[model samples]
Target chain A: MNLWLLAAAVLLVAAFGPALCVAAVAAPERRLIAQNLATVVGALAFLLMAQGYGRSPYRDAALVLAVLGPAGTLVYARFLGVLPSSRTVLYGAAIGVPAVVGPVCAAVGPGREMVKVLVIGALLVAGGTVTSVKGDRHG
Target chain B: MVSTVIVIALVLVGGAATAAVFNRDPTRQALVLSFLGLSLALLFMAVQAPDVALSQLAVGSAVTPLMILLAVRKVKRESTDQDGDESESP
Candidate 1:
């Protein structure tokens, strides 16, 4: 019941619940938006869980997700013939990733671990931007 | 707190799985299925199995949905080609 795990728990409940509801019931475009939201929240929660569990390897899941999540969205957009114009993932990458990654990086201080955290954060933001901007071209 | 996270993850997994089951449309079912994958990964993480979670994230979140969508697209394309009419039929 550490602070990090508590945060992860709250985030999972608050974000994932609503995202699932929308993804299940809404239109494809809206479902894509919710899926984007879920991925962002899931990544952040993974980061928090890594910190809580005191295991740097756990963060790899978040890193893999940072790469896969937006790509998954693009797959949906291409198949569904509609790209969501929502910038939720972009906003989460810019704002939420930093808010979660910064503290973890600081806690880890200067080291290979810190660099890994930074790289994952960069990937998250980059993936989000790609999904958000690419939609403008297609949508 | 770990127990609490686990319980929450379990509930999410249950909800997402149920949603996937109840959705009749294949495309929409694919969306819910992805959500189910995400939650299942979360559950695996909560239970201290990051390895499983990582693989689940790869397969569930991305691969499964992609496969379903591609299959649906192919089926619709072939059906429309056979009919030679695409006026929003089915």
Candidate 2:
């Protein structure tokens, strides 16, 4: 049994499943949070899958997700005109990204792949931060 | 083995799709739709189709939801504009 695959499976079943179920009935603000969190979970799962399959190219999917997930949230906030408040989401990323990506990086053992993982982690944090903040200032 | 992952993704996609149908609001439905997209992408990846998963991520995660929301916004604005002027009825 591959630990990475197990971790990814746990994430999909445990984290993403419940988050999505709740997001269904949650208020608009809560829905936004849930949706953004799902992106994080998805991206993280992709990272785990990459390691589990021993395919560096799999990480590219994670990278694309890291970049697009937050952008999608921001688009929701803009079009729907709602910005939910949640420090927990931020804190979760702050801790979760490093916690997951750090070990993966170390395990991959400093190299291009390690750097790619680190870059995806950074993108997740930065993109999450940018979207999680207050509503759009301009326009 | 991998089948477990595929099954989970399938279930989630089914749930999200049902939620999208039950939810009355276009905006919220869009959210569920986005979720469906995410799950579908996961399923694709699980099945060893990274290329399909990549395209799914782009369309499902952002583009699909954005199109729905934008359509909703446009409809609402047009309706409001019509409401502002009593002369135009319908």
Candidate 3:
């Protein structure tokens, strides 16, 4: 019922979902299991955020980040021929699920805390973008 | 509570940076980056922003490592010559 809780829930989902997708694609023999486990923990945190925040703007923003970030990355990878065209389906799922979740949260209740969460989500996405393209010459 | 979370987030960020610089091997560097992603995810949670953290964990920790590993494998494959015929054929 409370807005903050809904905001938190959205944040958690947006954060963890991509991690799961990544883990699924990662090398099996390497430390993928550990990464998956960690991602699961993060996903649980998002579920909590959804429960607490309910449906709100915060959730909506998270949904955007969740969908866009990975989709964008996948698109770029695809263009470069890193990922096969068939894998785009997974990208769709990654974006679609969160897109649905955001609207559900917003319809239930929109609150101020939602805005704060959205802002933070935006900043994180921006930071992530910078990190991905920036200094790491190793890439 | 927010302040404490922020502090923890900073510490995690620092840890990530430290790990990246200290590790020499590219594979090890990739692993450290995963740790960085995990830590950053916690930092996101600390800030009461779960969505960002989750995404970071996914891409930074999971996807990036996979890509790096793939690249490493490709490099390794290229370096090793499997066919003995190459030396004899010429």
User: How many collisions between residues are there in candidate 3?
Assistant: 23
Index of the highest-DockQ prediction: 1
lDDT for each residue of candidate 1 in A1-139, tens digit (9 for 90 to 100):
4999999998898888999999989988899889988988899899999999999999999989988998898888888777766666668668988988899998889999999989888888877777765435453
Put down candidate 2 lDDT per residue, A65-119, tens digits, no spaces: 9999988888888876767756757876888888889879988998888889999
- State which candidate, 1 or 2, has the greater lDDT: 1
For A1-139, candidate 3 gives per-residue lDDT tens digits of 4554444344434543343334333443222332323333333234334445443333433443444444433333432333222222333234433453454446545666545444434433342333233231221
**lDDT of each residue in B14-73, candidate 3, tens digit only:** 756675677666665665566567667656755667667657756875578567767876
Clashes of each: 0, 0, 23
Docking class of 3: incorrect
What is the DockQ (computed on Cα atoms) for candidate 3?
Answer: 0.09
lDDT of each: 0.89, 0.86, 0.47
Candidate 1 stretches greater than 4 Å from native: A133-135, B85-90
lDDT score at residue A89, model 3, on the 0-100 scale: 30
* Local accuracy of candidate 2 as per-residue lDDT tens digits, B1-90: 567777888888899888888999989999988998998999888888899999999998899889888898899999989888866654
